[model samples]
Target: MARVAGKVALITGGASGLGLATAKLMAAEGARIVITDIQKNKGPGAAKEIGGDTLFLEHDVTSEERWQQVVVETEKKFGKLNIVVNSAGIGTEGTIEDTSLADFRKMMAINVEGTFLGCKYGIEAMKKHSEPSSIVNISSVAGLVSGFQMCAYSASKGAVRLLSKSVALHCARAGYNIRCNSVHPAFISTPMVEAPLAAASDPEKARKRLLRMVPIGKIGEPNDIGYMILYLASEESKFVTGAEMVVDGGCTAM
Candidate 1:
């Protein structure tokens, strides 16, 4: 049997990168998927590729109204929501001194506030499910450690990490049968990072520099994180909650 058979999952930022990868994997595992993203072209295309009970909704993660609409539409189509993957995020490249208030706020609104809204509404929506559910927030290795020119990004993801734990604890204490956890990945190969890498003075050299930081000597594929997300979203992780799973190619091990 498929691991997530008969489940329904909502993944924000599912138009591309890790989010799209996870949506494909979950759908293959028998979960009905709803992919939310602002990118209209790719979002619908992804849903079509899944070719089953899947949907793509135009969404801005920081908007509370959009989140509520997603929840409503998810339930309307799937009858219940069993999993949520908060993969929508943006990154800024600047040290504290180089960072502007506008840049910092933009990162925070999309990364931090986006994650916050996902968790809040995810919990509310999951509660309606008659079965156990899971919430997986996509954080980053930067959230776990300090790095160059990633102050705002790290701070934003750090908030997601702690917020997941806090919400997990709250649900546990309340006896809500819902689990919440965060996944921290380091330099997963995705379009999100590709743009910044290409914009660097020497793109190839910059790519090499980033790869050197990973002890594993390679960048991660989208499916690497997708599979981890599947495990967390599946019934197999029934005992796990309020935890952070690091998928950083041993970057944090050093």
Candidate 2:
């Protein structure tokens, strides 16, 4: 049987990158997928490409009202909510001095605030049903260890790392049957990584720099994290909650 058979998954940032990758994988595993993104143009096409029990919604994750609406829509369309993946985030490159207060706040708004709202509303939606559910927040390896140029991004993701654990504990103690965890990936071959590389004066050199950080000697694929998400969203990870699942190709091992 499909791993997530009959499950309903709502993935943010699903228009592209790791979110799109996870949406595809879950759909293939028999999940009814709700793909949400701030990019209005790409989201519908992605849902169509997934080509199953899938939906696309225009979402701005930073809005509390929007988060509530998305959760309601997911439950209405799919009849229940079993999985919530907060895959939408932004990465800004700057040192502590280079990152302005506005930039730091913006990063926190989308990355931390967006994820907090997802967990808040996801818990509400999942509690409406009796099934065991999972919430996967896409964090970065920067969350575990700081990079000099990633001050704001690191701060945002570090918040997500602990926020997920808090949410997991809250739900578990309340007997909501909802599990919350975070997935940390390093240098995945997604648009997020590609954007920085594309902007470099020497794109190849920048690429090599990234490769040097990975002990595995290659950039990670989207499916690398996607499969870990699959396991978490499925019944297989029933015992797992409040955990930080790192899919970094040993980037943090060093």
Candidate 3:
């Protein structure tokens, strides 16, 4: 049977990378999806490609009003929402001395504040349904460990990790039957990783250096993380909440 069959999932950043991959995977497993991204052009094509009860709405996660609208539209169209994927985020690198306050705030606004809003609205929407629901926030191994130059990024992601845990505890105590968890992925070959890798003098050499961090000898595929998210979105994870599932090929283990 389809794991998420008949479930309604709203995924931000669904135009590409993990969000797009998750949308495709969940749709194939019979979930209704709302693919939201700032990329107006790519979002529609993604929705069309899914070829089912899928929607693509241009979303700005930084805006609380937009989050409100997205939730309202989702409930109106799908009647109820069962899954929320806070996959919209950005990557930046700079030491504490080199990082500007503006850059740090921008990173927090989207990565932390955006995810905060996503959780608030997602919880509100998911609680309306009796069936078990899930909210999966896409964090990073940076949240668990650290990068010398990723001070602000790590802080933002760390915020996401803890926020997910708090959401889970709240829902469990409130008897909402909702599950909230965080997925931490490291060095996944996605558009988010493309620019950083390309910035190296030799992209291939940079790729190899990154691979050394992953004990599994892989940089990870979007589908790998997608599959993990699927399990969390499904009934299989009904007993799972307040957990941090790492899909980083053991990067933090080292």
Best by TM-score: 2
Per-residue lDDT over 1-254 for candidate 2, one digit per residue giving the tens place of the 0 to 100 score: 99999889999999999999999999999999999999999988999998876899999999999988998888889899999999999987999998999999999999999999999989888998899899999998988999789899999999999999999999989998899999999989999999889999999999998899999999999999999999999999999999999999898999
Minimum summed lDDT over a 10-residue window in model 2 is located at: 44-53
**Local error of candidate 3 at 85, Å?**
0.5
- Give lDDT per model, in order: 0.91, 0.93, 0.93
Write down the lDDT that model 1 would get. Answer: 0.91
TM values, all candidates? 0.97, 0.98, 0.98
Q: Which regions of candidate 2 are displaced past 4 Å?
A: none
Which digits, one per residue and each the tens of the lDDT, describe model 1 over residues 135-230? 999999888897788989999999889999999999999899899999999888899888889999999999999898899999899999999999
Local accuracy of candidate 3 as per-residue lDDT tens digits, 4-120: 998999999999999999999999999999989989989989899878868999999999999999999999999999999999999989999999999999999999999999999
RMSD of model 1 against the true structure: 1.1
Kindly provide the TM-score of model 3 when superposed on the true structure, using C-alpha atoms. 0.98
Could you tell me how far off, in angstroms, the CA of residue 196 lies in candidate 2 after the best superposition?
1.4
